[model samples]
Target: MELLIKWLSIALSSSVKFFAGPLLGKVYNLPWWQTAICSFLGMMVAVILFSTVARAFFHKYMKGLFNRNERRITPNKRRMVRIWNKFGISGIAFLTPILLTPIGGSIVAISFGTHPMKIIGYMAVSAAFWAIVASIGIYFIPFNFH
Candidate 1:
């Protein structure tokens, strides 16, 4: 029905931005708030789905996909590990949204042994923050000048 289509459109549009904000912004003609809300919601969905996938299917079915190639943990890795260790789930959750893709962030949180609940909580907050900032930036900046 019409209502279902509309809801589906909103969900799809928002979810796409959740994964790829810049690309979705160009394609959807959505204002920043729309994008933000949709993207945040989408990211939350993605995080939850990803957490489930990572635990139930991805680890076994997509082992190669998630496999680490680098042998050296590197200074950045060390720093991340240290932060995660120090702050526990909070650190991973807070950083995941900003530092990684919805999928990547979820994977990293899992790899770091962050709890699923904490991962979702952190990602939700981080996604909301970025969405707000992105929306504000898009709204205030003038574009398409005559």
Candidate 2:
């Protein structure tokens, strides 16, 4: 139970900040590869939770929190829709992690009518790649010790 809570917190934290890779890595005290894997897993869990359960809940109970101009960017939506129509799930999965936080990216992908499975697969891959790269970069970069 405690472990589940900890992992859930990590997922939520990573979902809120796409850049939480390093923070999570440190907290888990994970080596570079493990950190990358855990971060990616956390992000994937977040995407799934947001797209299914949280999305409906937010729409029903916390709509105001997500109601913003950002959500209604018509031109951007059109562009995203076009891209989604053309590239299908791959485009959204590839783009979401780079372009938005896990929750926000998943929301946009869902709004664009992306298939949930594709969104999950692609976003998971993208998140894994980025987390690995970020984790390695952070772990390897040397800072001068004063």
Candidate 3:
């Protein structure tokens, strides 16, 4: 029971941020590959949850609101556009895990009118990549953290 709880805690923590599950697994001395898989699953949970909810809300209400309002574009929107033109969806997907939490990344992707499926797919790849990198990277630390 205690072991299950410990794993649940690790998974839940990782769902909020890309690196957290691997960090928790390292602290708990779990095997590296196991840590990577667990961390990836956690991030996927966040990505799926956030992307679906946000996208549904966006399409159902936010889209109508924006269309009705004719709101002027903000500077942030302009910047995002510039980045979008330059980097495109693949770049955003690649960077999301490194630069933003899974929730934040998913929201941003939704805001940009990305398909929810695409967001989750990108997140899956990014989460897996980062999980492996983070888990292995943690193993190389010369100084003991705990």
Whole-model lDDT values for every prediction: 0.66, 0.71, 0.79
RMSD of 1: 4.5
lDDT of 3 by residue, 28-143 (tens): 88788888888888888888998998788878887776677567889866765676788866667677767777887887788788888888887788788888898899866654
True-structure RMSD, every candidate: 4.5, 5.1, 2.5
Per-model TM values vs. the true structure: 0.67, 0.67, 0.83
lDDT by residue (76-107, candidate 2, tens digit) is 76777787789877777777666768887888
* lDDT for position 145 in model 2: 29
Indicate the residue-level lDDT of 139 in model 3: 65
- Model 3 TM-score is 0.83
Location of the lowest summed lDDT over 10 successive residues in candidate 3: 137-146
